[model samples]
Target: MVRKAVLPVAGWGTRFLPATKAMPKEMFPIIDKPVIQFIVEECLEAGIENIIFVTGRHKRPIEHHFDINTDLEKHLEHAGKTEILRNIFHISRIINPIYIRQKEQLGLGHAVLVAEPVVGNEPFVVALGDVIVKDEKNVVERMIEVYQRFGKSVIAVFEVSPKEVSQYGIVSCRHIERDIYILDDLVEKPHPDEAPSNLAIVGRYLFTPTIFEKLKVTPPGKGGELQLTDAMRLVLEEEAIYAIKIKAKVYDTGTPLGYIRTLVEFALQREDLKEPLLDFLKDLLSRDIPQIHRT
Candidate 1:
């Protein structure tokens, strides 16, 4: 069983620029909660008991979010905000959180490698901090289901347009059955024509402890960073790696556009803000004069 999860939060959010200079991208608000919170919630929902966060120097807030704020708790109790107190206490109970720093700005593959000491010889899930999966069922839960049935490593897959395949890790799946597929191979950022399949590997991953050994052999790729995808490709030769189509609308908040979109989408789902948010969007669209009009 995948009882532990590793989240790599050490990446520099250069895409977000000045805003990220002072704040971590994982802490960016998605409607009401931060992005990392969503990822943590996913792990908790999937029965993960331990969360290993491979964080960097500036990621104290991420750790703080998981720690119990005794002063705030006392205040909440004094103020008699029972509901708010319960909510705060609930986050503290989710998992046994552990944090480790990845000293170098290595790639995703290296980030996962840093957690090897803690992960030991158990299967664990690696969840990217900035990706939120809002689905009919929990994305982690879906991957866990595949892991249980196949007794092997699994990667969450989603169908992306051919044009967008180059921006993601594309996979070739032999067959599909109710959101699960048997992965033949994975090609990271392949050209559209060369792409084996349109199914792209999403952020969620279930891997056996052996991946650390494979990652050691995996060479650095584009930008001299050790990509997790490269490591998985090597492991595929010896182990069964499956892909499950996640039943969720994934939002990549690592980039500005995706970050803004998540805010809009999540805001639209909020009961109190939906009406106002809709009206605001309608007003903005109605007032925009630069849009090319069709006769």
Candidate 2:
């Protein structure tokens, strides 16, 4: 059973700039809740037990967000606000959160490698802090189901436009069933013509402990940092690797554009905010602002 999951939240959000200067990108709010909260909720729904967070310096806010605030709880209780108190306390009750500091900003592979001591020799899941999968069936749950059934490493993949193949780690695979593929190869950020396939690896993964051995030997490519795709390639030589084409809408909240899009999409789904947000959007769109377009 995959009881442990790793979340790498040590990245300095250079894309979000001034906003992320003081705030960790993972703590940026989608609407009312921070982005990491959604990922943690998904992990809880998927029955993940120990959530190992690979954080870094200036990430104390992430720890505090999950910690119990007794003073606030007392104040809410004294003011007779039970609902708000329940929501605040529920954060800490979700799962057993473990914090591990990634002393350097190496890369995804290095982040996962840092959790090796806690992970020991067990199969686990890695969910990127900046990605959120929204669907009826939780994305991590589906990946776990595949991992349990096949007894192999499973990665969540999604199709992207050919033009955008260079922006992701593309995979080459043979179809086994509906939305399932037996991975044959992986290429990181290949040009359109050089890509093996259009299927790009997303942010979720179910990896066996053997991956640590591969990651240890995996050399840095492009950037002077370890790449998870390279480590997975080494694993593929010895064990079977499978890919599941995700059936959910995945929001990559690492970039400014992606963050804004996710925020708007999530806000529009809220019952209370839907009407007001829609009206506000319509009002903004209805205005005749030719100068904005030219600029």
Candidate 3:
């Protein structure tokens, strides 16, 4: 069983600037719940026992969110807000997260590397805090199953358009079975024509402890940061790595535009907002959208 899971959320969200200046991007709400909470809940549902969070400065809110607040709990109890109290109490009490501070905003591979002291030799899951799948358990649970079957690290991949390959880490692989592949090579942000295949590695991964050794020796590549793709390719040199194509909509809330779209889409999925939101969209589209020009 995969007992531990790691989440890295230390990057400075420059793309979501002014708002993220104070608040962590992962704390942004999808309807009523925060994005990171959704991912943590998904991990817990997949039977993940200990969740290790690789965080940085200005991320205290993330820690406090999962910490107990006896005053608030007592107030809620007295106010008779039973349902709301149960929900929050579950988060602070049940999902006890272990936090490790990454003093530097190095890179994704570096962030995962910093959690090695807690992870030890066990195979663990690394989930990017900003990425959210509609049903992440569908991916995490399946990754756990594949890890057990192959005893190799498993990465979640999904088909991206050839033109969109440069935005993600592209993988070269050999077909093994339904929605599974034996990764042959990995390239970080390759151009469309140079991409090996349309399959792009997303933000979720199940990695063996050996990956830490690979990451340690991985030299900084694109953007002068240790890319996880670069380290995974090193892992491929020693042991086979598997890729599973997840069939779910991946919401990348890394940029302002993506965040706005996710907010709207998530709202549209709610019963209270579905019909009303559709009407609002229809009415807005019927009017003229004036384009603003720089003076």
Candidate 4:
């Protein structure tokens, strides 16, 4: 069983700018819950028993978010807020949360490599803190299903437009089954013309222990930092690596636009917030703007 999962949450989140200056990006709330909490809930739903968070400096808030807050629980209990208290307790009960400091703002591969000792000799899952997968069947759960069948490394991929392939790690694959492909090659952020395929890797990955060895020898690419795509390519040379085209609505919450989109999407789903939010948006859209006539 893939009992352990690694969550790399150490990025500096430079894109979010001033807002992230004092707060970790993962702590940014989607609505009522922080973004990282969604990722944690997905892992827990996928039967992940141990969550090893590869965090860095200024990520103490992420750690505290998952830890037990007895004082807060007591206060909530005294205030007769049982619903909120139950939710708080549920956060601490879901899984075993472990924290490991990355110590540097290295690339994704470096972040995963830092958790090697904790994930020793186990087939594990790596989830990016900023990616939110919204699907009836959790993305990680589907990837685990694929892993169980193939007994090899499985990566979550989605088809991107030819123009957008340069923004993601593109994979060359041969069809093996419905939505499953044998990953023959991986190229990180290649030009559209140079890209072998439009299938791009997303944030979720299931890997065998062999990947740690590959990560150790894999040289840094692009921005002089080790890339997870590079390590996975090395693994591809020796073992069979498969890619699954995810059937999910994926939201990249790392950037401002993506964050706003996810926030609104999530808000629109809640009964308490949906009507009010929709009405506010409708009112804003209905207001006419004063036109400036040009000579």
* TM-score per candidate: 0.95, 0.96, 0.95, 0.95
Spell out the clash pairs found in candidate 4: none
Candidate 1: stretches off by over 4 Å = 288-295
Best by lDDT: 2
Write down the worst ten-residue block by lDDT for model 2. 286-295
The candidate that achieves the highest TM-score relative to the unseen native structure: 2
In the predicted model 2, the residue pairs found to clash are none
Off by over 4 Å in 4: 289-295
Tell me the tens digit of each residue's lDDT in model 2 across 1-295: 9999999999988898887888999999998789999898898889996899999987889999998889999999999999989998987877799999999999999999999999999999999999998877788999998998999999999989999999899999999998789999999999999999999888899999989999999999768999999999999999999999986888999988999999999999999999999999888777897754532
True lDDT of residue 212, candidate 3: 99
Candidate 1 residue-wise lDDT, 74-119, digit = tens: 9999999999899879998766999999999989999999999999
Weakest ten-residue segment in model 1 by summed lDDT: 286-295
Q: Tens-digit lDDT track for model 3 on 1-295?
A: 7899999988888888888899999998888888899789878888895889999888888998889999999999999999999999988888768999999887999999999999999999999998887653478889999999999999999889889999998889999989899989988889899999999888889999999999999999878888888898889889999999877898888888888899999998889999999999788776766763333
lDDT of 4 by residue, 82-154 (tens): 9999998998878799999999877999999999999999899999999999887788999999999999999
**Over 4 Å off in model 2, which ranges?**
291-295
Give me the runs in candidate 3 sitting further than 4 Å from their true place.
292-295
**TM-score of predicted structure 4:** 0.95
TM-score of 1: 0.95
